[model samples]
Target: MNAENPQSPPVASVPLYQLKAEFFKTLGHPVRIRVLELLSTRDHAVAEMLPEVGVEPANLSQQLAVLRRAKLVHARREGSTVVYTLASAEVADLLRVARSIIGSLITDQAGLLADLRAADRG
Candidate 1:
């Protein structure tokens, strides 16, 4: 292998492990996930989002800040309010896939719990 081949792909200076860790860190919170889900549907004012997501204003604001910093959500000013939306339509697809996975996992867990309860009673 030639050391200076122009055709070679450039190596990433940041390690893949570090990048993965950061990605997971950004996604580890439930509130952030909900914010992503809401934005996936349409742009919404921060005040409007609070009631739908059932989170306190301070907490929702914090989660939105996290998503904004991660570049997952974009914001625009509308009069005195900030309207937030997904950075791309692809984000909505990502949220859909994530919800599917979570739904399957929850269903499986519920079945397992039922079996355990039956066994305990028997």
Candidate 2:
């Protein structure tokens, strides 16, 4: 243990649920979620993202700051352009899983509603 950073071990000792909750909290915003979804495909410049995301530059910048603090996106400077990309492939995997789960949920709800309607008519 380095005398300079004793807090590092405590961070590792924190419960997994707390870490997960904190991570989810970071993803609670729609803009942050959209930024992550776009970056999952490829690196994008701030200018390129603005139109696609349909947000003002200041709003997008706020979302990017949250993602950066969460360590979910990496930013690079190319001349005057600020390019953003996912920090890891796992973020993309998480997004894909979320889509699948929501899809399945909608399917289940439709099935339940159909059964209810059929029962009501019988």
Q: Pick the candidate with the highest lDDT.
A: 2
Clashes of 1: 0
Give the alpha carbon lDDT tens digit for every residue of 1-122 in model 1.
33588777776579889998997789889888878888877889999899888978999888888888988888999999999998889878977898899999999999999999999999
Question: What TM-score does each of the candidates earn?
Answer: 0.73, 0.90
Whole-model Cα lDDT per candidate?
A: 0.87, 0.93
| Candidate 1 global TM-score | 0.73
For model 2, give the RMSD to the true fold.
2.5
Give the range where candidate 2 is weakest over 10 consecutive residues by summed lDDT: 2-11
Error of 1 at 116 (Å): 6.6
Worst ten in a row by lDDT for model 1: 1-10
| Candidate 1 lDDT score at position 86 | 89
Q: Evaluate model 2: give its lDDT.
A: 0.93
